[model samples]
Target chain A: MASVVPRKSHNLRYKTLMAWLFTLPGLVVQLVFGWLPVLFAFVVAFQRYYFIKDPEYVGVNNFKEVVADPLVITAFQNTLWFAFLSVGLTFLMPIFVSILLMEMSRRTIRVMMILWFIPVASTAGIAIWKYMYHPNLGLLNGILRGLHLPEQKWLDDPVLAMFSLILPGIILFGPGLIYIAALQNVPEELYEAAELEGASFWRKIWNITLPRLRPIIAMMLLFSVIGSMQVFELPFIMTGGGPGYATTTVVMYIYSLAFGAYNLGKATALAIVLFCAIMIMVGFQRRYFPENIDESSENARS
Target chain B: MPLIPQVGRRRPKTRLMLLAIAIFLWIGVLLHLFPVAWMISASFKPTLEIFNAPFRLIPKEPSAASYKLLASTVNANGQSLNVDVFRYPLHIYLQNSIKISFLTLLCQLPITAMAAYAVSKLHSRRAAKWLFYFFMGTLMIPGQIAIVPRFLLLSHFPWPTRTVPGIPFTDLFFPSWSFIGTYWGIVLPAAFSAFNFLLFKGFFDTLPTELIEAARIDGASELTTLRAIMLPLARPVIAVTGYFTFTGAWNDFLGPWIILMSEQQKWPLSVALYKLQWALTSWQPSQGAMDPALQTLISSGVGYNALMALAVVESIPIFIAFLIFREQLMKGIQIAGLKG
Candidate 1:
C-alpha cells in the first residue's frame, strides 16, 4: 500500500503534464481570440479608437455620447419592439408547430424536418424577401391585388417595415429540430399511462408533453430573447435601417457607429449596454427556470 | 410513435382532430416552401415575366439565361471596363466560400476536440472543471460585445490596440501578424468554438473512463488514446459538430464581411451575395439611366434573376450538407447533446 501511493501519484503527475501539453494549442487560441477580446470590449468601450492613431482613454465619454444621441433612443426602442414582436410572433410558433407535427407518425416528422431544415443562406433569404416586398413588382402586393385586398407599402412604410422583417419568420414557421428532439426524449410510458387514465388528447399534451418540454422551451426562450435583442442582419440586409429609423436595432446602430461612422469606442459602449440588457433577461430566466432540468430528466429517458 | 397513440386513430372524433392537425401541418409546410419555390421560379424566368401579371409558379420561358450570367467566365475584355467586377463571374466567389468553410472546419475541429478531450479525460478533476469554464465562459456573453475588439485585435494581431506597444526597457517591439484581408482572419477566431467544445465535452463525459484506463494500461499516450479509441467512438458527436461548423462557416456573413471586405478576391458567397443584391436593388428601371454594372446585367438578359440564381447556387452546398448529415441531426438534439 505504501509503494502503491508513490506510483499512483507519479502516474497522475505524468498524466497532468500530458494533459497540459494537449491543452496548450487550444489555450493559446482561446486566450488570444476568446478571453482577451471579451476583456478588451470593456477597455475599448472607454477609449477613443481612431483609424490611424493610438487609442486614448476618454473616461465614460463614449457612453455619454451614446446617451446623448436621440437616434440611440430610437434604436433601443426599435430593438425592444423587435424583441417584443419576435417573442410574441415567432417564439412559440416552433413549439406550436412541433406539437402539431407531434400528432403525426415518427416517419412523417423525420420527412418534414428533412425538407424543412434545408435552409437558404440567411443573406439569400433576406434578399428573396426584399424582392418579394418590393412595392411595385413584389409577389406580396401581387397576391394582395389578386385577392382584391388593399395593397400596402410592405417595407416602405415605417409602421410596416418591422412587421415585414418578421413576416418571413411567421411565414417560414416550422417545428424546430431541437424541440422535436426534446419531444422525442419524452418516455412513451408517460403518454401510455395518461391514455390509460382516460386522458383526452389535449389533456395528454397539456399534462405530459408541455411539462416535459419546459426546460428546452425555457432555454430556447432565453436564447431567442438574446438573439432578437441583438437583431442585426435581418434589418441590416432587408431594410438597411430604412424608411427612417423604423428597423434600426441597437446592434445595427452599433454597426453603423463602428463601421459607417468609424467610431469604435461608442460602438463598443453601445454593445456593452446591449450585453447588460441580454444578461438581465438571462438572469431572470435562470432565476425562474430549473437550468439543470435535462440532468434530472435524463433518468426518465430510455 | 407520437403523442396520439395509433389506437386512438380508430375513434371518430380523434380521427377528425388528427386530420385537422395534418392539414395544419401541410399548410405550414407549403408556406415555408413558397419562398424557395418562388426563388427557383424567378431564377428560371425572364425578367419581365418575373413581375408580370398572373403570377406563375413555373416559368413560361424557363431559360438558363440567368444561370449563364452567373456561370459566365467572360471578362470585361482587355480594358476591365466594369468597375463592379465582383457582381458577376460567380465561380471565384463560390470557390472562396468553399475555401473559407473547409479551412475553418480544418482548423476548428481538431483544436476544439483536443481541448474538450483534455478537459474530459486527461486533466485532474479540479483543474478540468476550471479549464472547462475557461473555454466555455465565452458562450454566456453576447458575441456582439467583442466585435469591435475582435476587429481591432485582428487588424494588428496579438495586440488589442491598433498601435502596438513597445517592449519595456528595449527599443524592440513584440512580434505581430496581421490576418485582416486574409482567410486566416475568419479561420483563426472561429477555430475554437466553445459551443462545439461543449458538445464534444458532453460526448466525452458520456463515454466510460474504463476505456481510457485500459488504453493507458496498454501504454498508450493520451493523444493516442484519443485518436485510436476515443475518436472512433465519437463519430456521432463529430458528425453533428462538423456539420454545424461547416454550415455556420458557410452561412456566416459578418465575419467574412469584416475581415475580407476590402479583398474582393477573398469574398465568400455570403459577402458576394450581399454585394450582388445591393447592386441589384440600388437601381430602378423607372428612373431612366442605371449603374454600369446594372447595365451589364441588363445586357445579359436578366436583372434580379442573377441574384436568385446566386441564391440557389449558394444554398446548394448547404442542401447537400443537410442530405449528408440528415440522419445525424434529425436523430434530434438528444444525440447531438444540444439538449443540455
Candidate 2:
C-alpha cells in the first residue's frame, strides 16, 4: 500500500506536468494575440502612438479628440439606425421561417436546408449585392424598367443607401441555422396537445413554439445587436459609406481613423467607447429578457 | 367515433396550410437563389452583355473572356495587359488565400484540440475551472478593441517597437522579425480560436473517462490515449471545428486587408476583390480618370465581368466545402448551439 501510495503521487505529478505541456502552446497564442492586444487597447487608448515614434502618454486627450470629431456623431447615429433597422426587420423573419420550416416533411427539410446552406463567402456575397444595386447596369433597375416603373439610385441616394444595404438581407431571408436547431428541441407532444385542444396553427406557434424559443431568441438578439453594431464589410464594400456618409458605421470610422488617417490612439479610444456602448446595450437586454427559461422550468419540474 | 368528423374536417385545412407553406418556401428559395444566379451568369457574360442583359437569367452568349483576361499577362496585340485591377494574376491571389487559410487551420486544429483535451480530461476540477476562465476570458471583450493593438503587434513582431526598454544593445536584436507584409502575420494570430476551443471541450466532456482509464492501466501514455482513442471518437467535433475554422479563415477580409495591404503579392482573394471593386468603382472620367489605358478597359465592360468572375472564383471553394461537409455542419451547429 505504501509503495502504491508513492507511485500514485508520482503519477499525479506527471499528469499535472503533461497537462501544462498540452496547454502551453494555446496559452501562449491566446495571451500574445488575444489578451495582450486587449490590454494594449487600454494602454494605447491613453497614449499618443504612431509607428514612427515612441508612444507618449496623454491624459484622455484621445478621448477628447474622439468626442470633438463631428464624424464620430454621424457614425454613432448611422450605427444605431443600422442596428435598430436590421434587428427590427430581420429578427422575427428567422423565428417564423424556422417555425414554417418545421411544417415540411423530413426529406424536404433536408433538401431545403442544403439549398439554404450553400456557403457564400462574405466578400463574394457583398460583391454580388454591389452588382445588384448598381444603378444603370443592375438587375434591380432592369426589373423596374421591365415593370414600367421609375428607377431610383439604390446605393447612390442617401435615404435609400442604408435601406439598400439591408434590403438584400430582407429579400433573401431564410431560416437561421441556430433558430432551426433551437426549434427542433421543442417536444412534439406539446404541439399535439395544443392541436387536440383545437388550437389553430398560429395559436400553437404563439403558445408552444414562441415560449420554448424565447431563450434562443434572446441570444440571437444579443448576437444581432453586436454584429450589426460592428458592421464593417457590407458598407465598406457596397457603399464605401457613400453618397454622403449614409452608411458609415462606427467600426468603419475606426478603420479609417486607424488606417486611413494614421491616428491609432484615437481609433483605439473610439474602439473602447464602442466596447462600452455594446456592453451597456447587452446589460439593458439582460435586464429586459433574463435567460431564466430553463431554470424556471427545471424548478417547476422539481 | 366522435373524433372521426373532427379529423375529417381538419384534413383539408391541414393540406391547405401545408400547400401555403410550400408556396411561401418556394418563393423564399427563388429569392435566395436570384442574386447567386445573377452572379454566376454575369461572370460568364461579356462586359457589354452584363450591363445590356440585366434581366437575362442565363447569359445569351457565354464568354470566358474575363477569365482569359484574368489568366493572360499580355493581349494578342503585343501590349502588356495591366493587371493592376487585381494587383496580380488571379492565380497568385488564389494561392495566397489557400496558403493563409490552410496554414491557419493546420495550426488552429491541433492547438485547440490539445488545450481542450487538457482542460476537459487531464486537469483537476478546480484547475480546469480556472484554466477555462483564463482561456475564455477574451471572448467577453469585443474583438474590435484588439484590432489596432494587434496590427501594431504584427507590424513589429516579437516586440512592438524597434528597441526594448531597459535592455542595452537593443540594436543587436536579430531575432525580431516584422510580419506586416507576410502571410504569417495573418496566420499566426488566428491559430487559436476561443469559440472552437469551447466546441472541442464540450465534445471531450461527453467522452467516457473509463476508456482513458483503461488505456492508462494498459500502460498507454496520455498522448497515446489522446491520439488513438480521443481523436477517433472525436471525428464529428473535428469536422465541425475544422469546417468552421476553414470557412472563417477563407472568408476573412479585414485581417488580410489591414495586414497585407502593402504587399500586393500577398493579398488574398478577399482583399484583391475589394481592391478590384474599389478601382472599378473609383475610376470615372469626372474623378480625374486613372490611367487612360485602365479607363479604356473599364469602359469596355472588362472591369464588371472580371469582378463578377472573381466573386465566382471566391465562392466556389467554400461551396464545395459545404457540399462535402453538409451533414457534419448541420449537426455541429445544433451541438454548438445546445452546448453554448
| Predicted chain A of candidate 1: TM-score | 0.91
| Docking quality level of the chain pair in candidate 2 | medium
Please write out the lDDT profile of model 2 over residues B125-150, one tens digit for every residue: 99999989988888777889888988
Q: Deviation in angstroms for B98 in model 1?
A: 0.5
lDDT of every model, 2 decimals: 0.84, 0.84
**How does residue A105 of candidate 1 score in lDDT?**
79
Candidate 1 local lDDT, A1-302, one digit each (tens): 89999999999899889899878888999999988998999999999876766789999999999999999999999999999998889998899888789778778876777777777877888888988988776888888988999998987799999999888888888988777767777889998998889998789877788877887788788888888998888888888898788999998889888888899999999999889988988888788666575654664574
Identify the candidate with maximal DockQ.
1
DockQ of 1: 0.65
Task: Assess the local accuracy of residue A138 in candidate 2 as a C-alpha lDDT between 0 and 100.
Answer: 82
DockQ, all candidates in order:
0.65, 0.57
